[model samples]
Target chain A: MLSSPGGNPHHPSTVAELGEFGLIRELTSRLDTTPSVHLGPGDDAAVVAAPDRRVVATTDILLEGRHFRRDWSTAYDVGRKAAAQNLADVAAMGAVPTALLLGLVVPAELPVNWPTELMDGIRDEARVAAAAVVGGDVTRGDVITVAITALGDLRDKAAVTRSGARAGDVVAVTGWLGWSAAGHAVLSRGFRSPRAFVEAHRRPEPPYHAGPAAAGLGATAMTDVSDGLIADLGHIAVASRVRIDVRSRQLDVPLQMSDIGQAVGVDPLQWVLTGGEDHAIVATFPRDRKLPARWRVIGEVLPPTGTPQVTVDGAPWDRAGGWDHFGPDQD
Target chain B: MLSSPGGNPHHPSTVAELGEFGLIRELTSRLDTTPSVHLGPGDDAAVVAAPDRRVVATTDILLEGRHFRRDWSTAYDVGRKAAAQNLADVAAMGAVPTALLLGLVVPAELPVNWPTELMDGIRDEARVAAAAVVGGDVTRGDVITVAITALGDLRDKAAVTRSGARAGDVVAVTGWLGWSAAGHAVLSRGFRSPRAFVEAHRRPEPPYHAGPAAAGLGATAMTDVSDGLIADLGHIAVASRVRIDVRSRQLDVPLQMSDIGQAVGVDPLQWVLTGGEDHAIVATFPRDRKLPARWRVIGEVLPPTGTPQVTVDGAPWDRAGGWDHFGPDQD
Candidate 1:
């Protein structure tokens, strides 16, 4: 916990004591510059080079209790997860990320170190995607919220939108699928032995490069698996006006996830098919196109019969929910 | 007030009932596209044309109770104010608005119409600047937080930053100054009559066009008066390594603001000098350069002093505070 144990007498402990200007300086000074940034932080707005002529943009918000619990995850973990989510969205569009802007709301009395560490996390994760922290606004609020907007450049390539999938497309995905949900299950049960799963839940390792690579390979459609495999694929299905069917056998659930699922009296397939927040890169490519070793074929796109949808083993998965933000609140 | 009057029993009145996809469709359908938007909302990411080969981006967050009061202002007003604040930052960079992205966190039980109306407000305001609603995310949280990211195109011109001010430049401003502070003074007192001032408090009308015009007119440095004239100018002074001194005699305060200030037993000049959130354009131009009639010269920039700062007449303004987000909270 970075929430001040009250040790230092000379240094400011909380954000309020540091003041807005002082906090801005403390946060900005910690970040290094990136090539995409023309004018970085400390300006009215950041100028990011978008040589592609078009900029890909996406935004996501993580509320303290809703998306993450401070008691369960450190501020740094939250920051990394936040950046990964938005960057993944940009990558899903087959755009290489250029810059990220943060809109953060925190309690005035929050430990100054918490936000500073959070900034470090955002910067580090953005660096992973070769993006820079351009600019952001910090305001005082009762609820802690981190809202990130990531901008990307397509580099003369057309963005791979959800509507581009065709009937003869084969669906493939890279990166972890059930790991985050398995981790969440472990955390909820008050056990943390599966460090990998728990870490995935805390900070998602999105396959940022895979997106543009898939685009280069002529992917028809692409999306990040943020809201479960089926739910997000349903977005592609609806947008592309196609039907997608996933083969559960093709999904490789790690032995650890199965063990955790067995311990919890739940099926590991549920996590693989319906879990959210893993941020795996999923794309649809023409059936004749050869996919790389990293891309694993798991499904196929078909002509829309009735309403465009997703199915498991050629049937609608009975469990239909997938991290619907407004569905229900456990807290 | 859109919170169900318990009428229209068949209609889904709350966001929880509306669900995520339905709410998104409802919101996205209301927005019209703009030329800058290569691909609008409803995708993995929106593609915006950044014709200048550089994209200018800025973000801001507005929390429910901290930045706005639901009882005092409608969701539409909150949306407009939210969009205006971010758009003003883009304009402050001498960038013409291109697109806006929203990251909204709302209570599950919030009126469904609230967010929709908020979207309407955002769309209308973006239209005012010829920008489109490109992309966004929505999630449920205890507190309502609207985080907006606005992008702009510089149109092949250099971004006019705060650090460009020169020692021999004269400071000038366009748009309303201190109007929002005076309006806030009205609302805080529980008196909502003086409708124009109250409306200004609800929705600020920023001089977005003046920003690009200033850049074309050879302005040395510029910023929007979002943090009071002195405080924002203080930013310019610090960034430009110069001192700015404002002559109060040259500032013109409306008669209504004076009446309200007198009624509240406060000085209106204090509102004009120290108030924030009018979002007026303020810039410094070479002393010999001619500015169009819209810009009124109010001060001059001088060599760096003991501390590069803004002064009232020739000395520091005693009441130095602006709209410091992390400062003391009124709510």
Candidate 2:
């Protein structure tokens, strides 16, 4: 194992010591590229081909203390999570990821090897998605912050937007929900888990290919479950002028955090309904369309009434829920 | 003038105060979109056409305290500068900018208006460059950091890289040099500048159109002067396997920064030589090509020796040079 020399006391150097330009050179060294890259690093910009004419793009930022604590998560895990979230966004739009551009900022005193490990995780995730790390920028800052931009190819398929769902469409989801929130609860409460929940929190295993599959199957509307299932689905409901009703019974089978839910004295159903970060692909499709494997029919869309809303089993959920950066943390 | 409530105390009162979903709804409320945007912010991803087949891309991060102190630069100026630098990179690739994706991390206590101002600045700059802001993600962090990804269209022109210069090519530059560096010196050393240099440092006015113009004129190689002119030119020399000889006598024109250089007891030529952050366009053209109006030929590419080097008036320049991120700060 290559033990990362991160935070080593022996190397008491600050970013001010390394300077901006030199640190950039060090970070870019040893990175290789494919033929798709016309110009790589050391140039003013990089040129990449978007042969399909249309490009799908998304961006996300992960802050040091807020998104991932250095003490709780390794540098590699941070990189993986950051890249996964943005790539999931592209997938949610029914586009195949092509390339990623990263912008990283950290204090000068950080261990040099940490960035390499972070890059390793980023490259690992990129390979899994069949994307390339085309270009990136590094600079000095007070804390470690990673911003990633994912570019994707639509492959001539129409983009699955949040506004296309219609009344009578089937609402389906690919992969699990509430797992990350359950894992987050376990981590925040300092409780031990069966490794599954812990892995869920550290590195979310998003259903990478489900987006294109759903698009091929004629998904009307789609979104990744980054926020709670109900909350995110509510977005699609409002955009499509439809009401979404999810059956709680359908969630019982895939809701694997019943034990943790019991220990925390919180409803596992609530976790399934409002918990986020699962990155499951959720979409609306015509009732006549055949659903793909791994996708569970959880609900149905109805015509919007007075206010656009998401309901569970014909009633509004009152559980204080959904992830909010500016709001107080609630388990 | 609206005072930014960025440092306000009573921002997050209760979980119900802003509500996670409610906050996103409010933030994206007034955002307008152009016709080119096939999909906008509330979606899983946005689709934009890259009609030129090739996309020019670049990213940059600006930290609150390190890159710009809040007191020194307004939120709008910070946003403009951030967008400008990334747009300049696309221009350097001989491409026209198309879209920008920004990621912002700020403390929960930050005033909501500050983000609006920042976005306004970004929009203003995008208007100047004929680009649009497509999508972004926001999160809470200790300090404010902005990461921007810029995309551009090459319009079927070949990307002018740093490695295409040949021996005997005439080296020329469009836009001012050393002005930003001089401005930085003035800002840090508490020396008053002649307004132009100070403004230059705060906001560089790079000749964005000159990049594609050089490509149209069949320029062999091109790069933006982010680091000092000598250092950036040296990168071209090393990459293209050529020697570059600069003539200082040719640069006696009265740029707006001459008065500031004179007042500070610093040679204007030194500022012209080693100044950075100018975002000036530098390109190597065939000896017989007709040069643009604003560009002045200042040097020539020579046959490479064993070591790639840049010389002034046939003699090697020995001085503190180049903007090195990890190198020692000359301040």
Candidate 3:
């Protein structure tokens, strides 16, 4: 952890002591500029050159306690999750994320090292997708809120949107499913074992390259599974006005973690269906198209039966609940 | 104010009652898409075509009570102010704003009409710059927080960064200075008169076009006056490694509102120097260049004296305080 400019970690400078510009300089110094970032931090606005002229943009705001608990996740984990989620949205659009603009609001008492460590996490995660933190703003607020805006380059290929799915399209997904939900359950139950499950909830690793790869494979539609398999695909269904049917048998959920599932006393299928924050990609491709090795067929799309809908195993899902930000807090 | 789908204004639906997707649809319906937006809301990500290949981007987060208060400003006013500040950043870069992505976090019990009214303000103001709200997200939080990311097109001209100023360059400004600060003072003092000043505090109209115009006129460096004049210019001085001297006599503050200033018992010049949120364009240009009609010379740049600094009238100004988010909250 970096101490204050005074070089004393015991009495680290608060945001008030460092002031806005001073804190900004300290936080920005850790970031290394990339070639794609024509102009990095210190400018009023960042200049990111997208030779393709068209850019894919996405923004997500993560709040403390609501998105991640300080006790459950480290500052690095929060930062990495925030970057991964937004970059995944760009990836879902079949674009390569090139730049990110971060907006952070934290209380005055927040440790200066928290933000620096958070930025390190952001830079590290962005590197996975060949992206960099180009610009950002920091302000004082009551709680910590990270608002990230990620920009991507499609490289001339048309962006894959949820509206492109059609009848006879095959629904496929890349990256793990239900792991975050399972992790949350394990952590909530205070089961320290099954470290992998707990880590999934801490830092989700979305398949960044698989999105563009799926787009190249002629994907009809794509979206990241941030809000559960059924709910996210429901967005694609509604956007494309198609009926999607997920094959229960084909889903690659970690049912092997039976010990954790038993300890929590919850059905693994429930987590697989309604779990959120997995950061995976669920997309639809033409039935006849040969999918790449990363994708696994899990469902099939059908013509809209008067209205768009999603079904599991040719039956309407009885439990349709997913992550609702405004819903009652379960924990 | 728009009621929910039920069309009963007496018992309007709350955000929690409406859920995330439903509330997003309601907020997005009010937005109109611009030609530059290849795809709008309801997608994994928004696609905006710059055509210029290079894009300028900026993000800002505004927290309730800190940035704006519901009792002081209407929902419409808050939304417009949030959009203005971010778009001004793009304009300060000498780019034409093309798209905006808004991320909003509000309490569950907040009225559904509040967000709709806010969206209306955003759309109405964005039209001033020929920009569009291409995409956004809404989540639940304890307070009303708005995060806006704006994108702009340079149209092939190089971005006007703060680092380009040189000695012998003249510093000029467009748009009003210290009006918002005066308005804030008026409102804080509980004086309802001087409606113009109060409105200025509520809604700032940035000189959006003057930015590109100044760039066309070969302005060396530029930034928006979201921060106070001295503080913002301090940024340019440091970035350009030059000395900036402000001529207070050349400033055109609303001296006619001296009665309000006296009533508040604060120097109007203080507001002119340190007041923020005017959204004005302050730029440095060659002294010999024929500036456009909108540009007004207020000072001149000087060689750096081993350290970047700003002076007023050949001497360092005694008053250097400006708005600091983490500093004391002065009314």
Candidate 4:
């Protein structure tokens, strides 16, 4: 068993009481794995089956107080959110996630149950996309930080990149948008009755299958909505050298969210157009193509406008650059 | 481009001044890629070819104050050390390193030159192992934390796990041992005259070719010596259900190291046997095997004695469990 700096192994409650190896055992034992894991934990490295001959990989780091709030999110909620973000990135590349590895830094005085529950959430989240927890590393740090790297398989299909969109293509998205932001507004006011939005902020349900499905249906370009719709679509516009115009009327702003925005004296459309972390999958298809019911048409591609790359109703969204994860961002 | 919170982007000296996208561009542009990386950066995920149908992966996290001190090492040295630690784990699995992904957390006020130079170090180190920097994520945090995940190809060979060693096997090792520890001791004393030793502490040169070579030579078991030798071998013994005995007489303590030991009133042998972080390779082979000149025989496997799984010259090493990464570890 691995020793803890000053922990008593027999007590086995908090990290300082249980020791290091016990923490590992508690966290790893809670993992639910998939068949692609050729070698699990307990080795210098993990071996994962990659049948497609190529692996798709991405990584994300989440820090407490910045990416999440301990008072607002449980360990389980944080874990699911962490895995969902990176796994959604893999899916955005038109691949199916197969494995996840984690690098965690925990405060030694924290309760061991926190990490065990966190892994439980990670395991369950991975199972949603048929992926497995293969390996990870844990160490002591001043604050709690989780770094996740996800690997995926393309399954013989060419990856759909962000730079493939062409003028005259139509833009669409599958999965919830602005719900997390609306939830944050609700929680910011100290009200939790609208549990749906709060829960959405805590655990995002990404449409993982939509990515490869979009690729199969001949998607021209794709990206995940981690950075708001206009901003993310702006990336596509810049990379593809085209202009993107979103019809604000086409966006779906639920009554509850609208009510929350009204109560807070903010525009609900602002949240729908901007706000991040919902992990929604957005893509562009040929103008003549038929889209599935799950995809909501929101915008269209056009020849580049000299000044603005992304616009709403052929004009800039007045506050487009006013708020984002990049500007004194707290959530 | 991603906006900075409050600094002027045009001034671009610190992370706060350069903005997020500028940071990404600076770091990604410095990378030297390999042919196996079908898609490198600038995407939702990276695609790497895995010809062996199985991918070997490992991850490690290095915190600034705990794993490295800015005053003691440069960002480049920290980057090299972080990459080396994870890459060595992949090598221990009898695989050739192929790609590396990173998750970094940096303070916004930190200089922009730090991460750019850090990427240079990572890129050069990956080049040494014939690997590429494929993808990564960076975000703002209160403290600096680097998390690296390395992927490798096995080339159709089965993995050599720790449980494969048997009694009557000869133990051997390749690469520098205790050099980092001696260097650490030198630096701890506030003296920097021993340039070679201090450099070893800053940058470890892992034998990239030794692992696969040992596998081809029919090595029964293998692992990288990241933990102290006896501590890491103890893991092997427990997993393989055997006993291991090391010969202290066989160890070669350089004259300079012994002289440093004498001046510090410490035994150089202690550093050779118990010091960690000079990422050397240690493996077990059958007694009849003919090894290459690079491999040095140092011990032998024997039946389990139950109380002490690993010993030095037929008895306990004297202070096996008293010192390790798990107990009051500073370096």
Candidate 5:
């Protein structure tokens, strides 16, 4: 049911020929909308309902090859990852994700189903987050890229931020760490993994409720472990102007795929210390507050010791460090 | 300061070699943050302050080649477009734009300056919108793609939406239309145009405040015209369950680039009728309300005809239809 140049084509030519304006026109032509939209498509901005007065938001983008190999992860995986990351942000804000809008660009030669699959992934993730895929824009590009924005409902709780951590706060984690990193190590080395580790690398199941739970429990500060534990914890440390010290003795708990580390002769502690992409919930609580289940107290926040840093047993745990989009060394 | 595989080693290898988890770790390891962040990177989600309790939000994405030409538009242009679209979305929502989060994916071969330029564009746009670029993520991919999320402040007004149109409401527009479409025509046909039309095609200037103005005026339903007027109006009609009728006679305003239309023998009416991307604000208002200075009453909302559609002089205006991402035909 595809039309080419000869027949009345259903879709326009490459967005290049349409140019940005024409492409936007062709794409948005038939969208039926309402007053709840306040502003629909064109304008310096759009307005929407924020009855609670505060909006919860987050964003994420997925790239081809690095995030998903065309041969390995389907467009659906890309879409799911894109949406999940943003939804996780909303959850991190101690909000319930309510809506999402996506931006997508792909090569013209790519199969049309590719985008549809991606949308399916987006829809699937939205369902998990209890959010709706409200709207989006699409265009042609050299490679596939998916950008997602997630809006969440805060339910009026005070937002938990990183700066609130005070001395004597306990640091805890709600999900596994380093599984994704270890999984990547196995994948790159061409080694196989048990289902759990591979799945960790593919679709991270974030503890969405932990953010609000921590907020409700009066968490002084909170964050997701998208980066390695040490690195991410360092963020909390720097933001709170505090020093964090983790005790490795507290980390030998049962894990979903701990054996994967053994298979590779890799130290599980290293994975937990430096692995990222697990999308787990980490937060600081006053010493007296009870933590939610699965959240293990692994460290404590102290007044900054001249320099803000995260360490293991009072010493900086040396590792390759964390991710940076444009590091000084990045080309 | 570039890292290279050989030679002076400018940047490093492609992201695939570093792997997804590793890259993320490296990217996030060194970011400095503030206390308001309640939650920093690495968690189920990040928590930021929304002291006012009400929040505004919008999202948009840009693809390589489709929205921009690597040969023509710089990465900065791509970033600008991305930020502009989302900021426009926020304005459409009748909110004051505030903060932005970006997501980017590109081939490792991309120059580092490309992303820097993109950030410059984002920062510049944020400055124009009085917003801040707070956080973002980057990954390696085959093509460059940018996704931007914009957050806004409602400043205490109820969100204006598209579904509020009622019978006897006046239909009005706040920005120019068809210029971008006309500009696209000229660019596609390889015809040089007056600089205005070309510029309109390259970078659209959406009327930022028309959204909040409509909200202030108690406009019932609203939407930005990313799609053509008729198509986007159709959205309001469907959502509001009302029929919208526009009088073309009312739309015969002076077009700065009408010469371009005459030069190409293309009906300027076609551009006005179906062209998109001139992100104007269109809203339906009570007949008694005073119209804003920039807005022109173009039509009226009425009881739905069996078929929901826009009409000119009681008949459907035949023209090239608006854009559809997955429509069966292609031009």
Candidate 6:
């Protein structure tokens, strides 16, 4: 099971002891406001200065035991991962992340330090993305649930949608591939080596700037790798009505069965193909366009023949396509 | 105990049978778009045009068995109640509600039609507030949770904050006082009567237009009465550093021992004074200002003597202030 931060097993204060308002005061006291936040927490509603006259917004929820487990992820990891996933949505839209609204539901017996640490993780990640905690709500629940909404500005540029791809476009990715899935495999197998993979799974660092940069570079059909590379790409393919084919060799990774892979007893390549939660941005660019230094070409888009599909080496690689919320395994 | 809309007890399709994407498509297909929603659902992020260059944002969470109960309310009631609470926060800011993002977490066995009914409730309430659904996230969880984020525009008017109440300002309220609390009492004691109270509890109809109307008439401070009249007024008192003395007689409510009150054997005034979830607008105006037809004066702000406190009839009313998230009852 995941351990608390202080090392010693001393009992910590429960939320019940502090009360709702008191707990909120303690948790929000650590938040650092940014320039765009005209008003922060404690108000009925927060007023944010949206200088662009347009705001891009998206939301995501993380449920205890579903999206995460206390035994697998620390409280801070949960908070950081939650923020990363939502912010990645804003990035995928070719917008600059600006403000966030967090809603937390927790059990009464939860230690007060857990929520404080979670807020610390959220604020820390927001700082890296230059966003601020504009508002939040706290309530009691049977289990912990975190719902976050991230807002961004388009800065006068058109938002890149998954429907903009065309044939004869090179498919490229800006962040690490299969790392988060690899880390998940390691954790699931009860083995935690290869520090990078484990860390990647716990706290993803999405290439925040690369989204707007790709938009500036005239990239088409952009989306963040959330439900595995192939699954997310399938969304782009269907939306853009284009066929996408990936060249496995083009992915710059040591796909050989390593110690961690052998310990997990799963094909590393399978993880690379269908593993999710990486938060990497995959986009299609005109084949003749010069690629940015951070982007690596991994595939190309083709005109749809019958139905949009994502293939590897011109053949369908049928395996687990990724997570489906209410799929058979869950129920 | 809530019965499905179809009346027949035929087995409804479970969420698992539809999958996440399919369920989302079915649920969101009926959402109506507004002019402010430049980009609506189905995208990674929704782009909302904020012509005022400022956005007012707030969030709230409703958890099953905590904030709501299926045995007492239907899916549509839950959805409408969720939207009403968050939109009330926007109105408390004296802004025009613009858009909303909803995040839903439900058990895999939940009926597919339940979410559709919930969406219908959310959209109907949002229509009254002139807001539209922009984007949302859905996930699988053991219990039902709905987290909503409401966005508004100030339209060049300064946002009315709880910290602006000044001494000699008249306190006013618009909307029902204790109907929701009384409704809660009715449901708790296994008694249902006074259809008005029960309906109020199931679906709060906040005076959405009163907030901006009061702001136009020069309201000094404003807040929604989500936490009993005294408790919410206490928030203004603490934030603005002013003492608020509310006249119990001026509060328009039937404080007599009604049938429900006698059955529950609790003071109706207790609910009027400390009961929450009414979603009424509690605001302050200058003492000499002519009140609008929609506003009723209940008290006046006074300069703080030592510390800010909310008094009733110029005396301290010692009772339960309001609901506490992690109170003794919960743990």
lDDT of each: 0.87, 0.78, 0.85, 0.87, 0.69, 0.84
Candidate 3, residues B1-331, lDDT tens digits: the string is 3444446845446778777877887888788888899999888789998888988999999988788889998888888998999999999999999999998998998877788788888887798989999888787899888999999999888899999999999999999888888888777767876988888888999999988888888989999998789889998999899999999899886655677667766667777877889899999999999887777899999999854399888877666343232232233
Give candidate 6's whole-model lDDT.
0.84
Better TM-score candidate (2, 6): 6
- Candidate order by DockQ, decreasing, is 4, 1, 6, 3, 2, 5
Per-residue lDDT of candidate 4, residues B1-331 (tens digit):
3223235445578888777888888788788778999999988999999999889999988899989999999989988888898888999889999999999999999988788777878888898899999999999988999999999999889888898899999999998888998888888879895888899999999998898889888899999999888888988999899999999999879999998878866677778887889889999999999999999999999998896999999988875343332232226
User: Candidate 6 on B96-178: residue-level lDDT in tens?
Assistant: 99999999997899888788799989998999999998889999888889999999988888899999999999999998788
Candidate 2 local lDDT, B168-278, one digit each (tens): 899999987877777776776676566777788878777888988888899899988887788889989988989999998876436556665556555566767777777
Global CA lDDT computed for model 3: 0.85
Please provide, for model 6 over A1-331, each residue's C-alpha lDDT reduced to its tens digit, 9 standing for 90 to 100: 2234234355347878667887788778878998889999999999887888999999998888778888878888888889988889999999889989999998899888788889888888888889988889999878899999999888888899999999999999988777887787667657786778889988999999998888988988899998888889999999999899999888766643345556655556676777778799999999998987889999999989764399988888756443322121211
lDDT of 1 by residue, A76-166 (tens): 8988999999999999999999899998887899988889878989999999999989999998888888999999999998899999999
Q: Positional deviation of A60 in candidate 5, in angstroms?
A: 1.1
Q: Which of the predicted structures, 3 or 4, would earn the higher lDDT when compared with the native?
A: 4
Model 4 ranges off by over 4 Å:
A1-11, A320-330, B1-11, B320-330
Residue A303, candidate 1: C-alpha displacement in angstroms: 1.7
TM-score, cand. 3 = 0.93
**Which lDDT tens digits does candidate 2 get at residues A129-191?**
887787888887778888999888787899999999999999999977877777887787786
lDDT of 4: 0.87
Per residue, candidate 5 scores C-alpha lDDT tens digits across B60-125 of 676665567776456566666677777877787777676777777756665555665667767777
Clashing pairs in 1: none
DockQ of 4: 0.81
lDDT of 1 by residue, B123-227 (tens): 999988989898999998888889999999998888999999999889999998888888888888889969888888889999999999899888889999887
